[model samples]
Target: MSAETASARLADIQSRIAQATKIAGRRADDVTLIAVSKTHDAAAIQPLIDAGQRVFGENRVQEAAAKWPALKTATHDIRLHLVGQLQSNKAADAVALFDAIHSVDRPSLVAALAKAMAESGKRPDCFIQVNIGNEPQKGGVAVAELPALLAEAQAAGLPIAGLMAVPPFEVDSAPYFALLAKLAREAGLDGLSIGMSDDFEVAVTIGATHVRVGTALFGARA
Candidate 1:
């Protein structure tokens, strides 16, 4: 995308966020926009950053690793977030790269992060993935299973900042997103990763601290 095109798209997105926040009776600044730049290249991302986007989310660890170095050097200050299912084997590399992780769905991943964080001397903020839709095909702990998982993570010295979820693809998502926010409050968590290109306004309405927006900002991935 040309810089002008990318700038216009980003401006539209920010305007939507402002409108949504106003309707929701929340400050627009309350919502942290995470540009979901998973499939896009640094060429595409740099312009977005130059236009004043500081946070970006990536779905794969290796892909993020490959893109971050160049983007980091080019952009003055940027935060890389891992917003996808993170494997245990990638824990060390993840700790080295992301500023936060929004897919801590298993105890093993927690343990792996704890070990990796201690070993690498880094503590990347993290969120527990709650499978609000309870889809077996999705990657997250069931809602009913969260308390136990929270306990285990706390005991393991994992630094959990909040909860993350991808609502069912083909259903109304507001209820599910609200449910996750309620669960996060009950668990005393701080972050909510509950929005994407399709439903970010609803997410903001329902109090999502972080919204992962891709196509809405940079157009659909190629």
Candidate 2:
């Protein structure tokens, strides 16, 4: 995408976020817009960086490792987030690359991440992904199991930042977003990694600290 296009898209999303935060009686800077740049190459992503988008999310550790080292070197202060299901085996790589991890779901992955962080001395802020809709195919801890998992993560020395969730697709997501925010409050955490391109405004009004927006910022994937 052209630089102008990227700048315009980023501005539009920022404007929407500002509007939502205003309606919610919150500061716009309190909402962090994570430009989900998964699947886009450097050519596509650089424009966004040039447009002043410093934070981005990628799905895979390998893909991020492939691209971000050079990108981070070229630019400065770019934060990368892992917003996809993380396998236990890739825990070290994920810990090394991402500034924040938004998919800490299972005990195994939690253990793996703790070990990786301890050995590497790098603790990326972790958001426990909760399967709010109870969908069988998703990668979050079931709602019923969230408390236990949170305890385990805390005990394992994982930096429990907050909660993350993706509501069932094609549905009214406000309720789910509210539930996630409530869960975060009950857990005594602050960050809410809810919302995407479609419902980020709702997510913001409902108290999302981080919105992982991809399609709206980068345009639809090929």
Q: Write the per-residue lDDT of candidate 2 for residues 1-222, one digit (tens) a residue.
A: 999999999999999999999999999999999999999999999999999999999999999999999999998799999999999999999999999999999999999999999999998999999999999999999998999999999999999889999999999999999999999999999999999999999999999999999999999999
lDDT of 1 by residue, 1-222 (tens): 788887898888889989999999999999899999988888888888888899999999999989898879877589989999999999999999989999998889989999999899999888999999989999999988899998998898888989999999978999999999999999998788888899999999999889999988888667
Taken over the whole model, the C-alpha lDDT of each candidate is 0.91, 0.96
Runs in model 1 lying further than 4 Å from the true structure: none
lDDT of candidate model 2 versus the reference = 0.96
Native-to-model Cα distance after best TM-score fit, residue 123 in candidate 1, in Å: 0.9
TM-score of each: 0.97, 0.99
